[model samples]
Target chain A: MSAADTILFVAAWLGLALLVAAFLLTVWRVVRGPTLPDRVVALDMLVGIVIGFIALIAIRTGFTLYIDIAIALGLVGFLATVAFARFILASKGRQGAGVYSAGAPLQDTAPAPDATHVAARGARGKSAAKSAKVAARTSGKTSAKKSPKSLPASPAVAELASVPAASPAIAPGKAAEEKPSAKSIGKPANKSASKTVSKSTSKTRSKSAEKTAGKAVTKPGKPAKGE
Target chain B: MDVVFAIFTAILILGGAAFALVAAIGLNRFPDVYSRMHAASKAGTVGSGLLLLAVGVHSGELSVLARALAGFFFFVLTAPVSAHLLAIAALKAGYSMSDKTVTNEME
Candidate 1:
């Protein structure tokens, strides 16, 4: 056997060995990727490598049937790529532009009127009436402090004076300030927000891919290794 | 003559092996997805081309030789195109870049 032939024999064997290793790496990425889009990217690459390998094998074994595999790869791979991209995009609807689509948060259930508030107001009004009558009797001749605590008896009138205090104290201060919208109320607000962000980013990613691939790939004339 | 042909075939195969080895190593060692892709494309297309060339030489008949040649050229034409598509897809899928190679507007 010639030195060259020995080299070729060893090289082809090694080439096949390397391909095995590469395939495993691709598989690792495919399996371990954190997200759907990441796995799709790895799978797309793995398919391309597979097609190239098939083409090489056809040339090595002189089997045109293998070329059929390459052709099939070309057809199927493109479709699969598109499908995965669509899958990524389909998942983005909630993540981006549709963020507001989560709808308005429902208002807090109005607190039920309780006896305590009514009773407290009633007590204060009676005392205030008595104080006011005392004040009128004295006619400001003697020096005594007018107690504001002794307010009047009509419950609505007491509430009228106390509307600002009642309103502020009735509901939580901050929550009312930033009231959740109808849609977000009693709903998974955070989960939907995260989902929408993910989907829109995925869509942006696919759109960018379409742009990069817009060019025709240049195939240089250099001969491949063996022939 | 038989011995000579066999020896030559062996060497050609070995050359194919070396290129494949480099390609595989590149796939593993490259810093980012795009670089790994570059490795895969080069090794896959060109390494396959070499292996086929050796096969054609070993076969010796014009028809078989012609087929090998066609395969080599076909790989040359299509492998990069497919690889490019793959790389672009990876980039779109948010493959992180370790190095900023260039910032062309078309990118």
Candidate 2:
């Protein structure tokens, strides 16, 4: 064998060894990746490594057919990667149904209710009547703070006022607020205001809160019976 | 002439394998999916393309060489396109970036 032939033989063997190493590493990544995307990237690399292996084999075996095979493999790999991308996008919607999409919007409205709850708790430390009044006003104010442009004047504010007042002191306030939407109307005023704000800023959280309040008010006998 | 071609093919094979090894190491060592992609797609493409070129040179036939060149170009072109698609999908799907990532303009 000539010097060049010896060199080519050694180089082909060396290349094959390196490709085997690459294959193992890429497989490790595929198995260990924390996320789906990580595994996809690793799978993509595996395709490239396989192509390298195919080419090295062609050079060693003197079969040009492997070149055609490598090209076909490249085409298939590209298609696979794109399909995986589409799969990832489609899966995103399903993922959103569980936690992130539902919770993300709620984060905005959540703090508003939380603030009122905190204030109510602080006021309750002093007196129930005072805390009831403070909670009602704060909750109303929070819901009203957003979008002053279009207030549809919902009677839900009466319910909202009562909702935040966990104390029995709301009994008097509820009767008073119920008498005329005009009395507690200054603070936040209506459900439409809160609805619009919730829609523009966050929908699910405020909606959930409203649903809970509605349920609580609708079943007033439950609380009375419990007490 | 055959001797020279053999030496050239050898060199190409060795260089390609070295790049492939680098790509593999980088894939294992990178902190995030995006960085790992950078290693895999870029280095891996070059490594694979170079090996394809070696196949063409060793064959010494014009048609086989053309096929090898075509494959090499196809790899070079498609690797990045696929990587970009994967990245955008990953990002849109809400995969978190590495904590060590300094600045993320993609968000």
Candidate with best lDDT: 2
Instruction: Candidate 1: give its CA RMSD in angstroms.
Output: 25.9
Q: Model 2: how far is B10 from its true place, Å?
A: 0.8
Taking the tens digit of each residue's C-alpha lDDT, what string does model 2 give over A56-163? 999888889999999999999999999999887765422212111221222232345543433333322334323333333334545334423112222334554443
Cα lDDT computed for each candidate against the true fold? 0.47, 0.67
The fraction of reference interface contacts (C-alpha pairs within 8 A across chains A and B) present in each candidate is 0.20, 0.82
Q: What does the interface RMSD come to for each candidate? A: 6.2, 7.0
Q: Which portions of model 2 miss their true places by more than 4 Å? A: A93-227
Worst 10 residues of 2 chain A by lDDT: A95-104
Clashing pairs in 2: none
After superposition, the stretches of candidate 1 with alpha carbons farther than 4 Å from their true spots are: A1-16, A33-227, B89-96, B99-107
lDDT, model 2, position B100? 80
Chain B vs. true chain B: TM-score per candidate: 0.82, 0.96
TM-score top scorer? 2
